[model samples]
Every structure is written in structure tokens, then in C-alpha cells.
Target: MTILITGSTGLVGSRLLQRLLEAGYDCRAMVRGGRPKPAGAHAVEGDLFDTESLARAVEGVTAIIHLAAVFRTGDEALIWKSNFDGARNLMAAASAHAPHARFILASTSNVYDKSQARPGCESDAVAPTQAYPASKVAAERALCESGLTWTVVRFPFVYGDGDGHLEELPAHLLSANWHPAMRMSTIHHRDIATAMVLALDGKFDGHVVNIADDVPASMLDLIALSRGEMTASARPLAEPWAMQVDTALARSLGFRPTIRTVFHAAEQQLL
Candidate 1:
């Protein structure tokens, strides 16, 4: 089966592409003008804003892994356009050209409310304060209502594989005043590809699922694993469970994480 992957050069997409290719799948990556495609991926010159390019990108593919999004941006408008508008354009193209293709969206756990009554789950109400998560929520809604076979993979904190995501986490948490005791869910890069392969096989069709591992790690432990340090504090955490998610749904849907925790990743030298 031919799978069309968006955001093929970005961190998650790039790693995922290599995994898919190694698994011996026919992968077509959407690339912009003059950008070098990763080896083993067939390249298609596709732009999120360009309807013609999007149309060309989706044609005859068996499935689409929509990983393209903007999260680390100061520009709110660009975030909305790229994350929401770009997804809508791709959905439109898929609807017209590859109506039978499965559409898998890569979303974030940040869509859950900070004041949630319990651990975040797929069925909970969401009102994200940040534009990034808000736009991802909007994109997810579009895919659900687009009358296409769809799945949404809401990633928690994706790190590992020497991608530098973990290395940069300490500063972001420190600046945001995150409590050292506040535990957060995470998934290694290898497990993400495992979940995506299941999604491609219709294991999670027509559902929004959280893709996480067997364990959640505290900020202190995570920072230590990254070999970075966080300021120690016994201060109260206003939202201890804010970033945590419920992964029972994923396990029920047949996803068993290969890297069960940050410790597991460290032991395997995957971090």
C-alpha cells in the first residue's frame, strides 16, 4: 500500500518515514520546492497552501499520515493557517482524489484543559488556551467531519532517538515554572511508529486515540534522564495531572509500547 506522509522532513515525520521505509512500505513524502527528500522515500512536491500540490500529493495513496503542523511558533496566524487550514486543504484533496484512503492526523495532548477533573482522555471536553493546541483541535474536528476514514493520534511528549526534544525540555519547563513533581506522559520515537502502523492497519479506525507508553515520568526524573537539571522545589503544583493522559484506550486498541518508559529508552540507548 502507498502511504502519503506530510511534514516528512520534520522531527517526528522524518523519524517515522525511516521506520516505515525500513518496514518495507511504499512511502511517498510531501516535500516543498528544492528540499532534499530523505533516502528511500519517493518525493512529491507538495505545499500545504497549494491546492494543486495537495491534490497531486494525495492521488492514489492507500492512506495518509498527516504529521504536518506548527507548534513552536510565536506567530498565531501562521500556526492556525498551517495547522488548521493546511489540514483542511489536504482533506479536501483527499476527498476529491483519494476518497478511500485512510486519513491519520498527528495531534497533541495539549488539547486537554489544564483544569481537567481527571486524567485527559479522548472523550473529554477541550478548550486549549494556546493557539497550537486549539488549531490542532480544529484540524481534528475537520477530519472527523470530513466523511473520510480517519484516526487521530494525540501524542503526549515525544522524545528520544537523540532528536534533541528531551535535551530542550528542561529549559521550557523551567521557564514555565513547572513543578518537579508534576508527572508527564511521554512516548519514544520507536513507539510512535508502532502506533502508526496499527492505525494504518485499521486497529484505531474512526477514533481519536492517545499514543503513550506504559509509564509516566515526573519532571525531575525526566530532566535527569535528559542529563539536564531542574530547580528543586516542594511548592504546590496547581495541576499535577495536567499533562498526564489516559492510555487505557490505546492498550485496548492493540498498542503495546516497545519502549515502556524513559528509563527503558535510556537502557536501550535509544535516547
Candidate 2:
């Protein structure tokens, strides 16, 4: 079966492409511009905003893993165009070219309310305050209502494999005041790849799955991961709160995390 992957050069997508090839799936990497394609996969040049490019990319693929999104941006227009408009374009292409193709979207757990005391579940109502999460919510709605087989996998602070995603915490903290006690759910890149592939089964269609580790990580822990050590700090931006996600639904569908925590990542020097 052929699978087309968007954002194939990104942190999760790059590793996912390698994993898919190793598992013997015929893969197509949909790349923008001169980005180098994965060695074993077929290459298709495309931009999410370009309808012609999207049409070519969507043709004849058995499945389309939609991972292209904009995060960490203050520009609302760019965020909406990339995350929401891009998704609509791709979904439209899939509908026209490959109507029976399985569609998998990569989403974030930040769509949930920050004040929720328990972990966010798939059935809970989404309340996205930021432009990034709001765009994803719009994308999810489009995919679900598009009359296609689809799955939405919500990720929470994925880290590992020297991706330097964790290293950006210092800069993130600089822009917003965060308390050291703030906590968030997390997952490893390896596990994310695993979940994406497993989601291809027809049984998971129309489901929203949360992919995360068993335990949540604190802001201090993230800072430690960022600096490679722990330190004390008193910041007004952070609140003593947590936003955990329930992954039980995903686990029921045969999803198991290979890297259970960021500490394991540090041990393997992936951080």
C-alpha cells in the first residue's frame, strides 16, 4: 500500500518516514521546494497552499498522513493559513483524487481547557484559546465532516532524537511568564511514529486518539531537559497547574509507548 506523508522533513515526519520504510510500506514524501527527500520513498514536490501541488501529491496514495502545521508563531494569519487553510486544501484534494484513502491528522492536546483537573480525553469538548490549537480544531472538524475515513491523533510535547525541540524551552519561557510548577503531557518521537503507523487500521476511523506518556512532566522538568540539568527559579508566568491527557483510548487500539518518559530520552542521549 502506498502512503503519502506531508511534513516529511519535519521532526516527527522525518523519523516517521524512516520507520515506515523500514516496516516495508511503499512511501511517498510530499516535500516543499528543495527539501531533501527520504532515500527509499518516492518524492513529490508540493506546497500545502498550492492546489496544483496538493493535487499531484494526493494522487494514487492509499493513505495521507497530514502533519503539516504551523506552531510557535504569534502571527495569527500565517498560523490560520498554514494550519486551517492548508488542511482544507489537502482534504479537498484527497476527496477528489483518493476518496477511499485513510486520512490521519497530527493534532495537539492543547485544545483542551487549561483548568481541567484531570487528563484531557478524546470525548471532552475542545476550547482552544491560542491560534495554534484553534487552527487544529478547525482542521479536525474539516477532516471529520469531509465524508472520508479519518483519524485525529492529539500529541503532547513530543521530544527525543536530538530534535532540539526541548532546547527551545528557554526561548519559549522568555516570551511568556511561566511558573516552574506548570505540568504538561509528553511523548517520544519513536512512540509517535509507532502510533501513526498503527492508526492506519480501518477500525480506528473517525476516532480522536491522545498519544502521550504514562506520566505528565512539570515545567521544571522541561527546563532540566532543556539545560541537561535541574535548577530553581521563581517566575510569574508559571502556575502550579497541569494539563494531562488520557491515552487509554489509544492504548486500546494497540498503541504502546517505546520511550515512556523524557528521562529515558536523556539516558539514550536522544535529548
C-alpha TM-scores of all predictions: 0.98, 0.91
Whole-model lDDT for model 1 versus the true structure?
0.93
lDDT of 2 at 127: 68
Error of 2 at 222 (Å): 2.4
Tell me how many clashing residue pairs each candidate has: 0, 5
lDDT of 2 by residue, 1-271 (tens): 8999998888889888998899899999999887887788999999988889989998999999988888867899999999999999999999998998999999999898877657789998986879999999999999999998999999998788778888888776756555677778898888888888788766467899999877778878888778844445665533233467888998898888887788877887776
- Give the lowest summed-lDDT range of ten residues in model 2: 233-242
Top candidate by TM-score: 1
lDDT of 1 by residue, 1-271 (tens): 9999998999999999999999999999999999988789899999988999999999999999999888787999999999999999999999999999999999999999877777799999888879999999999999999999999999999998889998987778746778889888999999999999999999999999998888899999988988888878888888868888998899999999999999989998999
Where in model 1 is the C-alpha error above 4 Å?
none
